[model samples]
Target: MATLTSVYADSTIVLGPLATEAQPEAYDLCEKHVNSFTAPRGWQIIRLATDFAPAPPSEDDLLALADAVREASRAPRPAPMPAEHRPRPGGVMPGPVTAPLPPPPEIAEGEVLRRGHLRVLKGDKE
Candidate 1:
């Protein structure tokens, strides 16, 4: 029987390299897993299947994936107002036409009249 070298989880658990004619220890791993499992490349990761070795994505592939994720995160968010809640063209806005300003503190009748006249002259009467 042919010996198999398979990995499980993140660790390299070599299955029996049991040779039909030889002992179990004669079972050395295949070239692919040998280079992958032993070397500690930062970005190159590998997953192995029982029958065949899973191809490790190249550095360019990983970089492209990372760039896509970053771009998606930075994409512009939708505006706060929903389409239905948005003010239609030529339609009145929902909030008060203008919020009322706080009234001035109580003052003598003469002062109040003078302030009123000044407001009118400045075209700021409300």
Candidate 2:
């Protein structure tokens, strides 16, 4: 499966890798359609064939792996950070030191919504 994009102004058509995102001008085609595809007369078609097979690792890749392993093998990691330097998760986080005052001692049980001084209470009607 691949995406076919046409450039009318340049009279060109591109048959390439499937688009990551759909575009109004691009058409998604299956293998059969791609194989039997044709370009309009006087127009140019640029067909792109991509091989997805992974290539064998080269010497640079081996060297990079060796360097990483060497780094990993290096001795005792820097001594554990002192207790004071360690992050105290969820401890003493700075904010309004005083918590929002309790909801006015949970006034009346039927309270629905409260404004400054007025509270919309649930009506007794069902």
Candidate 3:
């Protein structure tokens, strides 16, 4: 595999064969199409020296991956509360309690209007 790229600034196109060495500016092309390269009528084609060796991973890429893994490992884990202080699985907690309020007085037939779960009661005239 090789790469072919058009450099608009210099009005030139380059065909570079793939090598272990990396050329930052070149785009990779399929091996089958290397011999079929062409350019516009006025453009010039430049052939770059190609090396077949594989490029080594950059230091920055390795460091970034290590930093990401370290950060994920450092995330805070939730602390478990003591059994006595924790709420019972299905029971309410003990607290200062008062008598429950009585239910509302029954509504008279004509004075109450019901809609869905709501109720409207006519006020007693003074």
Candidate whose TM-score is highest: 2
The clash tally of candidate 1 reads 1
Worst 10 residues of 2 by lDDT: 82-91
Question: What are the per-residue Cα lDDT tens digits for candidate 2 across 1-126?
Answer: 778999999999998887878799999888788888899899998988763223468899899999999989996688887443322223453444344333333557888856557789888776
Error of 1 at 12 (Å): 38
Clashing pairs in 3: 2-29, 19-51, 19-52, 20-52, 20-53, 20-54
lDDT of 1: 0.49
Give Cα-based local distance difference scores for all models: 0.49, 0.74, 0.68
Clashes of 3: 6
Inter-residue clash pairs, candidate 1: 17-27
Error of 2 at 61 (Å): 31
Clashes of each: 1, 0, 6
| Model 1 residue 5 distance off true place after TM-score fit, in angstroms | 30
Looking at candidate 3, the ten consecutive residues that score lowest on lDDT are 82-91
Listed in order, each prediction's TM-score against the native is: 0.23, 0.39, 0.33
User: Whose lDDT is greatest here?
Assistant: 2
lDDT of 1 by residue, 85-120 (tens): 444333556764444444554555434233433522
